[model samples]
Target: MESPDPSSSAPVLLNIGGKKYATTAETLTQREPGSMLAAMFSGRHTLPRHPTTGAVFVDRDGKHFRHILNWLRDGDIPVLSESEYQQLLREAEYYQLLGLADYITEKLSWKKGDGTLETELTRKDVIKCIQAQKTRFRGVNLSGLDLSKLDLSEVDFSYACIEKTNFSSANLHKAKFKLVEAACSSFEHANLHECELTGANLKEAVLDRANVQSANLQDACLTGCSFIETDLRSAHLQSANLMGADLNGANLEGANLKGAKLTGTNLQGANLQRAYLREVDLRETDLTGAKLGGANLLGTIR
Candidate 1:
């Protein structure tokens, strides 16, 4: 007695862990041919069915099995709660459903709105609401959040922990980042002009090609950060720790760097024209091809 063909339009019973589900063979094998369900039903080997119920047994979480079946059946996804969604996503990853996992991550983390259309009125309302609630920005984890191309100017993110967050190509002009910890974060090609970052820690952060002109970074730690070809013109760097930071081809024209720590920093091809560098430590720093015309280097230790 041979088993029925898996591709035959016959209904199949699944015993996923402890729960039972019923579906057609085509639903399991459709769309994603490389999926675990499809591979299981490929008839390459005989699957063990439940002894009593005669349903195919699968060693997976039965709770999130319905979502997988729903997706396979009609590509329908329910609006699940956050915890449920995460659980399903984890199961999807385990089952090698890359597309589904990516879709879930994007849906949950993508900021859907054009930042240019965010009016001052809307901003005021949001700020007022948060302030009324006496909201503290401390200890909030915003890692891997997509805030791209948003006009987040004047937004106070002071004392927040925003590790590994993405702010690429966003407008962050005059934003407050005082005492914030933002390690390994990406702000590539962002407009951070006149932003206040006093006492902030941005170790190993990526800010390549960002417009940080006239930004205040007093006493900030930027160790091993990448700022390649960035526009740092006239930016304040008083007492800032920039050890081993990459500032290749950066425009630092008339920038204030009084008392800045530049030990082992790479300033190759940087524009330092008329910049103030009083009492700054430039020890072991690479200044090859840097422009220093009319720059005040008084008491600077190279």
Candidate 2:
């Protein structure tokens, strides 16, 4: 009979903020190799153990430690409240678990979805809500809905999933669409003056002839979008992605394009007078017949 390994035979005991936990050393080191727990039990350093119980002492809140243990055991994290999730994220950062910290950060981006509308609403329900003056529609999933030609001005759509939704000829002036996932959506001929669209995903969306004047679209993903003849005067598009987008004959006078990615973008005959193009790489962009009079080309790569 072969002898068992001595390291695998001994179990590890932990004392975390007055709470005791019994686990194996293999469990700590096997899953998270770069974590503090793995380093402590890797037989290289001396651990600070309790004088009486001889268990390793970790000075941290033990409330969310169980979740960490469960995650180490079997890559699973249970549904946690906002507070609990925050606490777990802190613990994960302290323990140097990069993967867990990233996961928690992504979850935090959704803002917990508490008190936010997440259910699907029909067109009639939306119309009724609009009639009732319900402007808040944060975190709602309104994907694949036909809401064209409606006066939906000043509606809040932050963190909402509006993928493939149609809003042609709609009055969406001063509306809020912050951090929304609006891929493949349509806003043709829509009035979006002074709207907030920061960090929005508008990939492959159609915005032909849309009145997007004075709107904010910082850090927005506008890759492969159609903006032909659109009224984008004085729009804020800092750090926005316009890769492969068609901006043929678009009126972009005085628009901000600082730090924006314009790779493969078509700016044919577009009016870019007085526009800010600082730090933008337009080497692969098609700028045929585009007007650049008074446009800031500082730090712009051809």
Predicted structure with the largest lDDT when compared to the true one: 2
Model 2 lDDT on a 0 to 1 scale? 0.86
Query: Where does candidate 1 stray beyond 4 Å?
Result: 1-139
Task: For candidate 1, write residues 88-166 as lDDT tens digits.
Answer: 9989888877657754664344222341111112334444534443343332345555666766777777655566777
TM values, all candidates: 0.55, 0.65
Can you write out model 2's per-residue Cα lDDT over 22-60, one digit (the tens) per residue? 888887877889998888887777776767877887899
Q: Could you tally the backbone clashes for each prediction? A: 0, 0
Model 1 RMSD, rounded to 1 decimal: 18.3
Cα deviation at 276, candidate 1, in Å, is 0.8
